[model samples]
Target: MKKISIILSAFVLLSSFTVLNTVWTNDDPHSQLGFTVTHLGVADVPGTFNDFDAKVTSSKPDFSDGVFELTAKVGSIDTRVEARDNHLKSADFFDAAKYPELNFKSTSLKKAGKNKYKLTGNLSLHGVTRPVTLNLEYRGSVENPMSKKQTAGFKVTGTIKRSDFNLGSGFPEPMISDEVRIEADGEFVK
Candidate 1:
C-alpha cells in the first residue's frame, strides 16, 4: 500500500510539471509592440509601447493550439515626439488617465501559409472591445545559452481603424487617418 501511494504521488508531481511547461511569459525587454499611422497624408509616423506583457500557452511546441493574452499600458506610448505623445495620452486620444491599459486575447489561430498564421482575437482599447485579426509569422525558436531555456519569437501585424474603437473620433482622414497599423515583435520564454 505504501509503495502504491508513493507511485501515485510521483505521478501527480510529473503531471503538474507537464502542465507548467505549457505556459510561457514575455521577455518584455526584448519584446516590442508598436503601431504606425499616416501623418498628414504623406509619411507614416511610428510609435511603440514601452511597457507591456503577455502570456502564451501551448500544448505543442509548434503552437498550433496556442492561446495568448496581452496587456499594454497606454501611457507608455512613444513616438519620439514628446508633445505629440502627450496629446495622444490625453482625452482626445487614448485617455490614458481613464483607460490605462489595452488588452488582447486570442480566440483562434489558423494556418495562412508556411510559417504564417491568421490570428483572430478580441482587442479592447479605450473601454471598447472588438474583434481583430493579425497576420502572425513564426520566427522560430532558440535556446538561450545563459538561461538554458527555450525562447520563441513571433512577428504580428494587423490594421485597425481608430474610429472602430471610438478613439480619436471625428478626426478627418487627411488630418489623422482612421487606420492604424499594428506590429509586434514578441519573445516568449518557457
Candidate 2:
C-alpha cells in the first residue's frame, strides 16, 4: 500500500509540469522567420521569409508550449542563390506552384528541464507530413521592444530527410545529404 501511494504521488507531480502552453509571434523589426540548410554539408547558409507565423503552448512561458504550429510560404525560400532558390520553388522540391506553403504543427510537448523541452510535431513539406522531434531550449521571456508585450524566446532544432518529401529528385547523385537540419530561433507572445 505504501509503494502504491508513492507511485501515485510521483505521477501527479509529473502531470503538474505537463500542463502549460506558450505561444509566439513573428514580428521582429529586424527580420522575419526563415530557415536554411547546408549544401553537401558545406557551410553556414542563411535565409529569411517576408512573412511567417508560429505558435506554441507550454506549462511555462519560458519554454515550448503544449501545442505548436509554424507555417511559412514556399515562395519565400531564399538561400541567396537565386537560381537554386528558384529551383527549390519548382516542382522538383516544394512544388510551390501547387503546394504554396510548408507547415509544422505540434501534437505533444514534454519538459526536459527548467528551460528545455522535447517537442513532437508533424512537419508538412512538399505535401508529405511526417512526425519530427525538436530539442527546444527556452531562452526566457522579455518585453517586446516596439509593443512592450510579453514575449518568450526559444531555439528549436530537428532533422528531416529530404528524399522523404521527394525534394532531392534531381540531385546529381549524392549531391546533397538526404538529411537536413532545421534550426528555428524566434520569439513567441505569451
Name the best candidate (by TM-score): 1
Stretches of candidate 1 off by over 4 Å are 2-21
**lDDT (10s digit) by residue, model 2, range 132-185:** 888877787778788788877778877777777888678733466676767777
CA RMSD per model (angstroms): 2.7, 7.9
Off by more than 4 A, model 2? 1-23, 30-34, 40-49, 62-65
What is the TM-score of each predicted model, taking all chains together?
0.90, 0.77
Residue-pair clashes per candidate, as listed? 0, 13
Whose lDDT is greatest here?
1
> Compared with the true structure, what per-residue lDDT tens digits does model 1 show for residues 80-182?
9999999999999999999999999999999988888999999999999999999999889899888898999988999999999888885778888899999
Give Cα-based local distance difference scores for all models.
0.91, 0.73
Q: In model 2, where is the ten-residue run with the lowest total lDDT?
A: 22-31
